[model samples]
Target: MGRVKHNMVKSLGKRTSSSVSPTDGSKKRSTLQMDLEVLECPICFETLTKPIFQCDDGHLACSSCCPKLSNKCPTCAFPIGHIRCRAMESVLGSISIPCPNAKFGCTDNVSYGLESTHVKECIFSRCSCPALDCDYTGSYRNVCKHYYSYISSRSTPLHHYAFLLYKASSTVRMNISDKIKIHVDYTNELLFVVQCFRESYSVCVTVSCIAPSSAKVGKFSYQLSYTVDGDTMTYESPDMKRILKVSFQTPLEKFMLIPHSSLRGDLLETKLTIKKVIQV
Candidate 1:
């Protein structure tokens, strides 16, 4: 089995010989194709990059995981994280690939082990679709287009408010969002997702922006107010969270909490005001 795998790798290397020649004929490069699992740390199963450490018996580990294991090698039960694995570091440094988000408008070529880190910070990284039936995934801009197109046919006409890039403040009437149901609204370029669910005897209303993690839009604060029994109830959040997906399993840290008594026959009429905060 080992010999067959080695022969396969050699075959791949030979296949790239003609293609890797530079136009100027100044140099030749060959692509090494192999299973990436071999480059992952056994402890964390993450790509191994710089500062890799090894045990006395040649068991390797990443730096972040070494301390958790108490500097002991799991394979050989020997002292670890003391000796540097320069060979592995050199191998990792030599291996580079285009960013996984390259097709999504990212034009970076990153080191092999550092691809995961780069993708996390890449603006072009794809965000998951919030809809349950949709399997769409794309960059932030593309995701917005897809979301708008998907909901456009079934969407009710909303009161459009022009949100200024520098300063924005708007108060709008929000229709009742059924219990444990999702409602999506758009104000200018931003999309707002609202969800309401019965929690014990109270209703929990959560509102968030469906955007990329690195969106440059300024911070937003909101105030939700509703009238019940001729009295007014209000909930305010200093900052609204941004999410890539609609998640019901995780409890939101900030949300509007309304008592069951505030409901008017399974209906809740609310008014929402959103303002963008300016940073000095």
Candidate 2:
């Protein structure tokens, strides 16, 4: 699921070969990367997996792509079915591959058979915090530890405000986020950011909202409701108001700690919906 969110595909293509002559008529061998591409599944373009299936004539397809194929091999009209390519599986086992989330801060070198299991539990897998007033994102387990704190239970009547984060890592404030105040010279020209706070005795979730770019932002206020640590709370931002040409990136502001063991299933599986509440 996490892999799908980023749209970073890991497809491989069928072995490709062509006879060509360069201007200099030099013959060069294909690189290792090119060799790897030869193993890609022709159906999905993703890299092949173990237990690769093949036709009697030896044309190959991954376990995932094999089931989707017709009875006949796409490459050759040979009879194709659930024939495991043990040789290919052995080849896969001998290779070491990096976890897909390596770009996201995960640094694990897993054997072919264990790659799936490692990625499933990669700590750096993204589960961003999207609260109403701040913007922040962290690993799946960690993003659930942040939230917002508003000046008023409802919207602040005024527009000028500063952003702040309070630490509840323990009874004492483990760390306090830096106060963010825009550096505008004039008096309160109605420019400020709000930070709202909510906590639960169980299932704690942290939130930080990232405001869209001025041009991309719509006229919309926001609301967030979550039950955490056996506590339920809802937070509402000010009503939608359009801004003019001036713009700034939304600042980040709060967090509440939640342990992963307490959650029921994959943290990546948890989905939060953002509704655009409208008033006539």
Candidate 3:
């Protein structure tokens, strides 16, 4: 009976020791698990991707953290301006971030420092062409095509012989001929150049208002002729505001017209009116 009682006591002791060992091991494992799971930015409360340190006060934050504490800690009111830790930064930089737009069909996980650059070049990014009366917006390639289509639809058709005129100053008769070349002056207030007739006869034109605050008023005259391979060809003017004068020398047609320019308080305005004279 005594031997049985002693063995029972020893068995109970062994059981207790065995139970205590597992409990201690479980506690240690639980602590390690908590430490592994606690990796997150304190400021953002998200996974610690691109982590940055606030100070020695144990404020771990993300790199994109905003200045919310006026350069001081909100919790302890500690100055954080001079506080920096490169080791913490490197640790944060090693973290991975799930795409913010992941729900929008992005499945990329990138470093926090590379998030902005990735978003900039993302194929899913949409942009719209900035044009009046255009409603097109899409991917970069689509936007390019949309812009081209809009521009092509609104572009003015070029004519074989065309003349554009603007007013410069009063009593100054400036003529832009299809047979003359025009040059622009950058230093002058109004500088432009016109070229015609294969750059044979070019003209440099400039006009400045006599008064800085007031607009300069003037008129313009234009003459246009069409030719092909040194042979005269028939041509026509498409505007009617000017008196169209047409003359024919064999197969060649020459047209001349006078136009006007107006100014209102430093604004110069000119309009071109085209009229048809000949087709062949």
Candidate 4:
């Protein structure tokens, strides 16, 4: 009976040792797996790219991860400020990222550091051409051209003319007709009159009896009348004079005159002149 008891005890000891070995092994394997899975940023499930360290603690996070969190860590409530993590960042710098919008149209994949910039400037970004039935897909410049063509096609028929005026010793004369246009003149204000029809037009009229250095000289006002054959529109006031003088100061390159042809009906002829300026 003693021998039987002895044998049973030995068997039980062997069984216990066997079971303990596997448990210890399994625990070690599990720990290693967890360590392999640890990554810097929780926001992006991937390994940290462009890792940034917290100011309060030496905790590391991904660059893409920090913005979503409050200025502190929820775990420690440490005031998290931006600090570079050279080690983690170097690791992330080696990673390549597929374009986030690859499914939309972008075909290029770039390093994680350059991903945001490339995506922002991607040419394949979806944009609609405002022109009807024109399904054009290209860069920004191409899209601009498409809109320009649309405007030109829809433009109303109009004529444009311009003349250059040079200031002489005693008088001013029109040197050459730079441009002329049939334009729709809206109400004439002191500074500008809204013209509707023409694509471009300008007229140059010279002012005489002005001192070169005097800032107040050569100021004048003129009543402008628009008459096409018999139909007439007249605007006369001190304001009209101010508008013409202002036009002279404006660069010719920036000048745009709206034409009458762009209007619904009837053409109007117009005459403009400078009245006088108070000598200073």
TM-score of each candidate structure, all chains considered together: 0.59, 0.39, 0.32, 0.29
> How do these models rank on lDDT, best leading?
1, 2, 4, 3
Q: Write the per-residue lDDT of candidate 4 for residues 150-258, one digit (tens) a residue.
A: 5457655222322222221111111123222311111110111223222344332222111111232234444445444456555444422211111223333222233
- lDDT, candidate 2, equals 0.42
Best by TM-score: 1
- What shift in Å separates residue 135 of candidate 4 from its native position after superposition? 9.5
lDDT of 2 by residue, 132-221 (tens): 354555542243333222223445432333322211111111111222212111221122122222224323333322332232222234
User: Tens digit of lDDT per residue, candidate 3, span 174-224?
Assistant: 234322221222123221122222112322222111111111212223323
Clashing pairs in 1: none
Q: Per TM-score, what order, best first? A: 1, 2, 3, 4
Per-model C-alpha lDDT, please? 0.65, 0.42, 0.36, 0.39
Give the RMSD in angstroms, all C-alphas superposed, for model 1.
Answer: 7.7
List, residue by residue over 115-209, the lDDT tens digit for candidate 1: 65676557777766666667898765566667667766555633322222222333433334433333334343456666677777877777676
Q: What is residue 95's positional error in candidate 2, in angstroms?
A: 2.0
Residue 251 in model 1: shift from native, Å? Answer: 3.1
